[model samples]
Target: MSWFRALKDTTRSGLTVERKRLEPLIALRGTAGLAVVIAISLSLFGPAVAAGSAFGGFQAAIATFQRSWRPRPELALASGASLGVSTFLGYLTGSHLFLFLPLLGLWTFLAGLSWAAGPTIGIIASSNVAMMLVTITLPTTVAEAAGHAAMMVFGGLVQAALVILFPVRRWGAHRDALADALAAEADYARRLRHDPVAEFDPAPLMLARSAAALTPRQARTRPAQLHGTRGVAERIRPVLASLADPAVGVPAEGPERDRARELLAAAGSILDAAARAIRHGTPVTIPPGAIAAFRTPDNGTILSGPAQRAADRLGPLLRDVVETAGGTLPEEAAALPPAAALRRRLTRPRRPRAGPAARPPDLAPLTAAAPAAPPYRDPGRPLRRPTLFELVPAAVRAIRREARPGSPVLRHATRVCAVAVAGYLIGGALPLGHGYWAPMSAVMVMRPDFSQTYSRAVARFGGTLVGVALATGVVQLAHPGTELSAALAVLCAGLMYLLMRTGQLASQACVAAYVVFLLGMGGETWSQTVPERLVLTLAGGLLATLSYALYPAWETPRLRTRLADWLGALGEYAAVVVDHYAHPAGKAGPEVRAALLKARDAHIAWQDAIDRAGTEPVRHRGLSNAAADDAAHALHHLGRVAMLMEAHLPERDATPVPAAAALADALRTATRDGARALRERRVPRWGPVRAALEAWDGEGVPDRVVRRGAGMLLEALEALSDALDTDVPPMTVKPAHETDGPREP
Candidate 1:
């Protein structure tokens, strides 16, 4: 996913446990400024000249203020200054297209470029639009502009003060990230129980893992305390994945088989409880009976070796979940009888390779292992800080990419610019009152991809209609005084920000009301604006939607290419990680870690590409639904295998793993052939990778962990190969075990 997706206006799924639980807390960001407007109306301030101060606070709070000193003041000050300057320029440009067109072009270029920098730029984008549109119809002299500028800065300062005055815990979001992943894992377990051949959605778990991977780099969390969160998830993925495959997991159809399912379901429940605890940053609570009932190897009905093995492998994972919840041991576990003699009698010593094997990560300390997983980073070169200087260069780059013929971003930019210019010219030439609205809507609604553009345009159209209608009713019902109007506007602004991440319709509606009240206090009457607002908004929406339909970024033509991109990245990531496994010099070194991180980034892009491709008009979609499903499932399965391998690397090389290297090369070749196959309308032979995996020397590797990991690589390769031939559909793929197929580890 791109930075823009992460900055989603509303929180996706509303699953974040850290999100404010109370209504007032949700509205605080908006009210911080309303309080200022009230003071100004009460004559607590000298004049209405500084009214932009309220908006300044409103903008800064939207930046997600925290107790940290680094970004809050910086964002607040920058936004206030930008708002002041842009507002002034826009007002001046209102009288001249010579100034407006070029500046608008420059701002749009900046908006396009800022997308790579992350969600902050999105907030800045809204600010840019507001700066232009808010005062176009109002009289703005140099003196008024200066006063408004200062006032907005004052509002930003007020927001900063409030942030400092009211502090919240910093780990809330981080905790939720880990919790979300665990919960998703639990869900996966439940799915495995219900349908042995089922494959659960990996998006949520992937997103959560990615977010949790960043905890170390962010503020407030103790790095050591939580380092193992992702690592824990990494180890657990294969376990859950194994369960989803009945051939390698479930026992025979009998009471023993029933017992295995019950235990797995219980394990899922415990993990869910653990996720809840982590989400709330509290101790996990569950009945002691839940833990007690998890005891395995029961019923005296001998299960098939695979079923028995699956049950045995599942026990430690359940215990790990309990440990992660920061709860006391179960009553039975609290005072366990010593098993030293029994262990000596039953355990077989793992054979040494040439030298002593490095100690594998202990499962006893589950949280401690979480940090061991490689941290996520950009797969490509990291973006430089966005600046005004880069605007021209970025534009040049955009032109060049699009010049190659049909770049999505370039196409989108052209669409936006064209529609914007048309709206501007049409609005100004005709006496459409405050004609900027048409162009504003046009620019706001058009997106890089069709789905977002279409969806947003619809939302904007429906939202504006309702929002403006409500504002009109309220204004007519109560011709309130300036103070009351200002207060209402402030309140509406707060609600808008609160709903931004929760509901787009609500946010849009609140914003419409805010605009109405804001203008009312600024000496504009609702009666004169309603009809104009409706017409302008409708025109903007229509222009945006039809413009895109005419100049479409058709999905079918690009599906193969997008799929190719994902396959290529997947192969590269898998190859690198396997090579590292074969010849690991240091545990989790920068090179291997970087490769793994790069894979994560590629996976995000691939996922987005596939999703966007799916949304394209099916009539023109070149790919088959079954093929699309296979591609996604294979890619996701490979990604998890890579992640699991990345987390379980040994500290030092015992012997160079030739098998892993061979497997890596085979994958690269397959990937290359696969891409070519797509281009040539043919399927690639995937036998080399499967052969390489099968050729692995598990016996030559002394470390059980390393050997098991190697075996898993082959098993996954076989599964993916089966998928390519349509021999094993997602709903019926063979189960992967920790060892050779059908063989006990």
Candidate 2:
């Protein structure tokens, strides 16, 4: 039961979007689109190769239909080029065993190199491999090979035309990314108002980060500049978090704190307005004093105290947001609240906090984005990259990068090439019919990491057996003609495409049906091909699994390095943000942004490593899973706090706080020492961090500013220490009232 509960704790069901609910409509569109292309080809080639052309059309559509707006010409060209090269290799390898084996290994090896460019290029490479694996074992000459490749290209052209004509959601991804972030911010703000120091789930923020990943190169800009809607979303998270810092005394026992909470609530209202404005693409209309209210502080709060500091931090950020959001500041900045009632109707109420088991669905915010530039391009225009001329140099560079001994891509590619060669040899040395399926299956099943490889192998084998039986049964029952078989193939292709994002098993099942029906249209009967396909697929999966079992890409060896990397980056990020607070001179420069990006990248890398390691074999060395997870959770919490610290980073130069500077230095030292300890196998000291915060007396104005930041930092650091030093489950994070008291490290 305990293990089951832990397993549940780790599930990220919150991140998933329910695509299955919309699959039926997606399937219909996909089927109709592919069928139209295939129907035309049937008239030209009839049954001889109509099936191949149709399958090509299906594959083209499936591969190219991503969240972003792809240029139709680029899709047609990339697909055609991949098909052309893979076809040449397939034809070359079909006859000559001596030359074929070595070249096949080399080709697979090179294909792995494609990953360095990006996943977009990586997908193209993998598709090329898959196509060739199917084509190479075919009984065809050079002339027939050209015809087959042309048919594939023709199929791609059809899909491209469909895309151009249909013109579906072009800016959907960017829109969703922005909307999700704002929604999450609103949710976080709502929770903050309820319980300023509560341990809120960080999953929604993670979801927003993941959603905001598809940044357009054209949209890249300076720190003060608005890159995209995502940039605004990123900026607002810290503001919301800082406002809710319990140790900052924004909600502590005082009239001044009460006033600060009201201001925080007002700031939240502005966020709501911004979210709504972005959602509808309207100019922002905040309450008259919303912007000005933050600028002019109430004199009742102690000078440079928590209330004054929170207001000081939120002021410039609010002003920047107003400019970015295209909001107009009223001439009389003091007439606040009720006057902004016109805009109030446009905003939404906060959602009720979800139960623990409630998976995150979506968020809608009421805030605005800081817009610094006009749109890079018209939203209606489909974005395109520089074409294939640049690919040669990129591919060469990728190969060079992958040649490094420690490169993950190099290791993975080597494994794939070795496995492919082995499967090909085993198939050729036996009596299996068109045994290339074995090699194809092996390559397809072998993922870069162990978890994916094992999972995919199981899915491929099980889905194939089930699919073969089901497809064969349907074919025997219907005994359809050539045209009907072609239709069935198209239908299967469409359904497979729709189901791909929903479930791997369902997609694989449809793939089996599609293949069976497609080959049947080419005069290969189900009875003759089903057994061969089944046997080869099973063999391929087994071979792929056994290969990994023998020489596993275990995450244990990489886990320590990743953890150290994350800690180092986190420390740097925290220190930098702290320094900016201590010395807010030129806060609008690029240095802070650069540091934040590095930290975010490192955090992502560590999480990815943890996930992959979880999928490896159970006998992990160097560290246990529970300890690793706790460590990651600790770091993630630190990262969240650091992000908040960054959001409220002061904009004007201030007298440096000695205590704050000391704490900053301590963060740097601890990170360096901790990383070294983690890597070299030692228990790192947390004394410096705890001691620095304790000795910092909040005596004067400057020290008070430092105290606010130091207080929050100490609490976060202590949480990190607790997670690292103990085996306790994470309980509610209350304010650490014992910062000045003796503590166990």
Candidate 3:
């Protein structure tokens, strides 16, 4: 990509407004917290103290809005306390530039390292550094600084108190995450009705899994409805796929296909109903038609073999979903396998017995209290995330791992630290009244990636211009007193919260206006601050952009490594799935689950690298665009084949296919060698995999699904080999896989 194209794309990205639903109530609540802190501080110590303290409430409110599983009040408190400490330390050295510059560099570096923890921590830590620069200029003496710092902490305390006193939709984020996952599955079910082999992105399920992780306190207080449903959702995806596949399950043109369509439609409706119930904490109303379809006896007859089995599995799972949604689920119900769970209560017996007919029980809300059993854990435990405090040592280890040459985090840290110091020196030398604005802008806008850093810089500068103009006009027209300015500042803060989800441009615009009004309350004139702020902000943005251009950590160079990682993970996943066919009694459920998770993570990493690489002004040296696209296409099919095989895994006591053992070994060996060859920039030859597939070429295999998928897998690998060869013309390339066609009965 050329520099001009990169710049144009990033600018468009910066200007793009995401069409997300606005949370007015939550934003209003956050604004109210800011209002209380400002009102109280203004009453006690007048406008200047209020101005300094508002930063605490303001930043803390932002922190609470981060996408973290931790409690919102806890986030608010931690953000507040951290900002206070940063401000106090910054004030200590504010008198001497010699002392402050060193402190600034060290603080900036540490903030950069905080990314190892997670984006939430990294964002909060970066804000801490930015606040240090802005707040240190407010206090004149050490005693005064202590008082100001205490007031800031008090601001955070006020927000936390407000959260406890008037909670809004408690456990709301968790509910939303769980609901989104179910909704995605519902959509997938609908799509599969037409395109049985349609692809489903697992991102939503992954998010729900992350949301399920809880602190001990959260676990104790969790709502019963939120428990166990996630596991049921996980089990449903495979069943849905298996039932829809033409080769293994239903026929393409027959009455059985119509029955399959009816089941899928009913499943979609049930899933949709479940999602709504889970989201709003309401009673689940299972559609009468959906229940009737499941109860239809011909469902068992028309859908025979794998299709029948999948239909059987899906009915019980959906029942659990409805029961769980109505809060009527037995706490110990999760311990039962999906095929056995809720069978007597929700599902009618498949055959009539020599007994009286009983009506199927309605999923009524049950209030009986039993000791909650430890929840059914996922095989790989991929959903488990460390608590914030627990992440400290892990974060330290990550930082240490990145403390080497060519580590992107290390390069980013060094780049940011250098740019901040330089921006500060330049801003001070130019006689800017608020020199801190320069470095603060630099710190806030400079991210580890080219796209974000550039987009944010563009957005920040544009937002500042609009904001400063609007704010200065207000001050000039109204000639408002300190109290009015403070009120205006509160209003602007509210607007920022409301628009935060829209885009960086909208939120940053409000932030600019809020800051202008905030500083106005502290007796800084619009004339003195407005022009200086605009100029300094531009300088900071320029410094950040220029620094990246000079010392870039291009994702293009790491593309091969990321691709190799994904190939290896996908190979392991395929091997585990195939191994299940070879040794049915081994029950490699945990291993398969773990391998799938690792493969998913690697896939995400590779895609992210590609996106980052696309926006970088660098040549694709080793891997051309055409090659990368072809390779990714091939790998995607390989993964889908593994997934399809996993859906048809044999039961524990089922007969093992001895031929699968050789294929599994070949997959492991070939992919390991392939990854090594990829890293070394050589065209990998999958001789072993090809040989293994040839051995099964003409055999009358009992396990048709495994054999067919292995053929598809080998085809994908061969295509991958051609992609990496570089000798093949991009225009002559052919895809290994095709959209699956419906089969006749």
Candidate number of the best TM-score: 3
TM-score of every model?
Answer: 0.74, 0.77, 0.89
Off-target runs (Cα >4 Å) in candidate 3 are 329-385, 586-588, 696-700, 728-745
lDDT by residue (tens digit), candidate 1, 633-652: 77676666665455445458
Candidate 3 Cα deviation (angstroms), residue 40: 2.4
Please list the residue runs of candidate 1 whose C-alpha ends up more than 4 Å from where it truly belongs after superposition: 1-23, 41-51, 63-78, 91-94, 136-139, 168-170, 213-218, 221-227, 243-263, 293-324, 327-406, 498-502, 573-600, 634-660, 690-745
Better of 2 and 3 by lDDT: 3
lDDT against the true structure, each candidate:
0.57, 0.60, 0.80
Candidate 3, pairs of clashing residues: none
Segments of candidate 2 deviating more than 4 angstroms: 1-33, 66-76, 137-139, 194-228, 252-403, 658-666, 686-701, 711-745
Which RMSD does model 2 reach against the true structure? 9.6
lDDT of 2 by residue, 1-745 (tens): 2434422432222122235544455456557767876777678766655665665666677656543323444555577557656776677666888888887888788776666665556566666786677754442677766776787787777667766666443333444555556666666666766666544443444444444433244223111112333454555566556656665446455665565566666676666665555544455556645443443435233324443544554543554344344433434433333423334334322222211222211111111211211111112212233345655675676556556655667667887788889888887777767677788888876766665666677677666877788889888899988888887888778777776776557777888888888888888899778887888888888887777766665665667667777788888888887877667754454677777766766666666776766655545545567777777767767776676666555656555655667778999998888776666544456788877777765334454334555566666555655555643332233211100100000
Better of 1 and 2 by TM-score: 2
